[model samples]
Target: MVGRKKRTTICDKELQKEDLISNLHEPLISEILLRLSTKDAVRTSLLSKRWRYLWQTVPGLDLALYDFLNINFSNIDAFFKFVERFFDSHRESWIRKLRLYLGYRHHICGLKSWIDAVTRPKIQHLDVNYYSSDEIPVSIYTCETLVHLRLEWVSLPNTEFVSLPCLKIMHLKRIRFTSDTTLEKLISGSPVLEDLKLFGCSNHNAIQLRSHTLKKIDMDMDHSSGFVIDAPLLQCLKTKIASTKDFQIISSGFPAKLDIDLQWRRRRPLERPPKKVIRDILADIRRVSDLVITSDILKEFFLYSKSRTVRQFRNLSRLHARFAICDIEMLPALLESCTKLESLIMVI
Candidate 1:
């Protein structure tokens, strides 16, 4: 009797729970749908007539060519048609975010028009990862309302007008800039940018990163490319020095956490040892508390030192090193330099 009573109570509650969600206001339903992916949001239309256009009116739009409506990859035209319909049918006063990903080169033809349609009056976040030779829309450079911008595998535009007054976070990977100054113009215009990351970007032999408001920077560069950092308030820096040019950090002080990857010195009749470039960087950042370095840095650096004393790095507290068997002789020299080290990590 007790078990039967429990089953009856559960069924009674299920019967009492009607379509309460449908009874809510359209604003509430739209808010609920906005939290869903664009494809899942459109699926709600099957639930009832009230949800027919709720997805189109959402504040955020996330559309990828592969995931939209389960479109067939064999027919690329169908995907384009769906995108056109979504742009034409959807209406919004302000879009908070738009994350778009295009897979193939054929999609480049429609990129300009699609960018225009989505560059609304108050779009804040725009993330686009489209691989193509075509340049991204020029409107993106002057997006005043954008706060966070992330681009990958896209060609940057060359325009006289470059302004992003509200931009805070910027991340670019595999981007092809028209010229070296094209990136500089964008960085100069962003008055409030803080966090920056660059990985495997091309079309520049030497890039100068001069910013007053920048706090953190992480980058990867080739042996032919170089960086000139001049951020006064930078807190942390992680980058590789592969250039022969003597680079300097024009900061008030070295970053708190300095993660550096030093290149190997070339031994030849013409090319000389890179003791000065490696030593200058270490001397400039000697005040850093936490440091991560490779064995090549110690190999070329400590081998040229006249004395094995620990006078350079008096403020270093934590040291992490990836030591190789060939350069294990310099490990003792590095440890001997960090007199104030509280933590030591080694990878052999």
Candidate 2:
């Protein structure tokens, strides 16, 4: 038995091509193939001639400023041409999302054709955030594929009308409204919208809203004359106001009652309120259950009470005063008087 020993050795060569093929032919590997970014997808071209086609098949393409910080902006025409070539190389017919965030002065004459080319009907999500030369393109109003729109520091034409039928949500910040009617028409057309946010926008013109599906709205019309809101199914309303002069709120469908923060300051020396101004303001939100009042408004409320009998908040369940320094003692009695109020939050 000792004389019949056998020799064993290991081979250092790689596995055969057929054995490696089985590992590459996987469902998880196929998904990873589809989700590769533009840069990473190009690397796969060196893997093999067969892998070169995978780069063109990937459907997603995102070009933001952070992706190319060192890009030469002085030669804007050349930079865009290179990006266009890259986009044209991708053979995907349908893109799920396209985001363009290039910090350049958006001239209408040069940008119009480029914008029209990218807004294919197949694109479901399109986010275009660009700083313009104080002007917004006209094609934005007629884009029918957008589901969500976010605009900041953009100047839209007064005559331009936005009539996106498929739009579900809109957020406008620091956008100068051209005319009151333009804004009104936009809100009226977007019936399927569920959420809307307006920050630092002037609303001097009359506004009308009629949405069957709208649920939440957060408006910050600070330091400007306010506008009117008339939404039927709006559930939550949160607002911030730095100036209270001529702050008119004419809401007919006083929402499902979520959270209300109302603050009115008396920085302007007004002798007295109009006969029925402030009373009408409080009456509009009489049905809201939760109320959050700031210091200035609380002082006005107590001062108005001293002059005449103002209706106590009967439906309010919770009262929160953010900074109640001198008016801390009156708050406990105010909370107990409201038959429905269960708790009070005060910070002196």
Candidate 3:
């Protein structure tokens, strides 16, 4: 037993850990870094020598260009220098995706320079959530390499030339266009665009969305008028009932899943929709496969059914109805109309 104290194992020398994460394959590390926020990814540089430049090799602004550009810094000129260094570092690299939440008022000028720097690279996915009143750089409209673009609350000026051959997805929300034609030009330029989402966008002038390539459209405007969508291959169209109680949807009958949600409002007894009018609207929505509406709308159809006929929803498979107290009795009528409805959600 006394002799047991004599041996010192080699395992004791392994006190300094193996650092298994750093030894992982380079691509795996890059992917892990990609999941991190642009700021957090760059901060890995301070962890160890192996991690120092690995983050820079990660795709897009995972290299953390946004860290220098997006912050509301006190010494913006200094941050601009860091931005220049970031571009210089990536002069030969391909940045596929970049997201910039451009901060409060003061950083606009430097932020534009940051945006300009990105234009040099073959950027595919660009998300700019800008808060400033000034327009984003027009060069963005002509980015041939952009595959996905999201612009929110930014003023977009009408540019002479717009071309995005590779763009497949576009999300435009609360965008202020110098002219309504700017939106038309942008959509027309994105030849391969398949999915488009518009939220809180209002246009007084006529804009034509004539996209053969478009498969899905999600538009939710508080007030929209004089816009037309001619998507022949349209697979889905999701929209809010714009103009308060006026539901106008062009069901192309291309197996499109049209989503309609009716917003409720109090009206005088005389202001109720005419019996024939409700029947006409119901007939128009006969092909909408997905329908979400208030139960009160069912009451309209119920009252109309007593006089004129209610059209059968042959295509409707899903229905989500929010019930108002007085309109709950009309539930049976709604169920009777949607003969093929497989999924029904009745909200109390």
Candidate 4:
């Protein structure tokens, strides 16, 4: 009888330790629950009475409906409903970040409403990927507190007036702009933007990027167009151009890095780019320290060297060239121009 009493006493001590742990305050408990998926987070309420209302206060929401891709119609409908309920149950006054990745669908009104509801003043990061060709709601542009924004496969709103006072990083992929001036106006609105990336964007004749605060610019486009860069503070630049009609550089701070790839369509072979074209491009970025030039571009540069004067790349230290054996004749002239080149890479 005495041994049975001792066992009961030890069991009571273990239960007491568990009670102390489960009784942690809501903020601490919410942190533990926030790492879980939204569905799993919500399901925590069923664990015990102490956790019943704790999941509702999580500060961030990460909802990914990847299963929506393979699920049946009824399941998709149910999944959306579940999302609605989750949002309705969420009671956090300030959400730190919200991410949504969804497949192609025509749920415009629902998406607009959801965006309007979640884009509060406290939201700092917003990422949305909708594989459909729907136009993004203008409400996102008014997110004054957003620090980072990423959007894919969406058309930007056609609003002349845009203001993002705190945005710093913006990435757009497969985005459609309403007009030529749309991109310019959008960049102008973000007074303090630092990094910008554009990939596979459509519906623009030319992109004139003029910014004093931009530090990095990356662009990959399939269309034949030109770029006008005036970012004096830019440190890194990467671009893939389909045609070499014109690439104007007004001004840039150097000791930078440049990666350039130029390709010509097979059906329409472009005439050799003008000697002045190559000279102007090389002269503007002459201060770059690292450079990569593909075989096709080097061929044009080689042809240009035969006619025009080759400018010196005094600050260039590393050069990477992808060239054919026939283009080897240009290497002497190219290497002579780089007075300080320390490393050379020749890829066949």
lDDT of each residue in 23-103, candidate 3, tens digit only: 889889988887787678878998889889998777766323345555634465765565567667777777777776654
Model 4 lDDT tens row, 1-348: 999999999999999998886888888888887777666777788878888878778876766676443542255667677667766766546776777777565353467677777675567878888875567778887788888888888778688787888889999888877777778877888989999998888644767888888888888865636778888888888777654534566773552788887655343475655555566666745757888878777666656664332554556798888888877787787777777889999898
How far off is residue 137 in model 1, in Å?
1.9
* All candidates in order of TM-score, best leading: 3, 1, 4, 2
Q: Who is ahead in lDDT, 3 or 4? A: 4
What does candidate 1 score on TM?
0.77
RMSD vs true structure, all candidates: 4.9, 8.5, 5.7, 6.9
lDDT of 2: 0.60
My TM-score estimates for the predictions, one after another, are 0.77, 0.66, 0.79, 0.74
* Candidate 2 Cα deviation (angstroms), residue 48: 16
Model 4 lDDT at residue 142: 76
For TM-score, the strongest prediction is 3
Candidate 1: give its CA RMSD in angstroms. Answer: 4.9
Worst 10 residues of 1 by lDDT: 264-273
Q: Identify the leading candidate in terms of lDDT.
A: 1
Error of 2 at 347 (Å): 7.3
For model 1, state the Cα shift of residue 283 in Å: 1.8
Candidate 4 off by > 4 Å: 1-57, 68-74, 105-108, 203-207, 252-255, 265-277, 306-314, 320-337, 342-348
Instruction: Note the residue pairs that clash in candidate 1.
Output: none
lDDT of 2 at 253: 66
Candidate 1: lDDT over CA atoms? 0.76
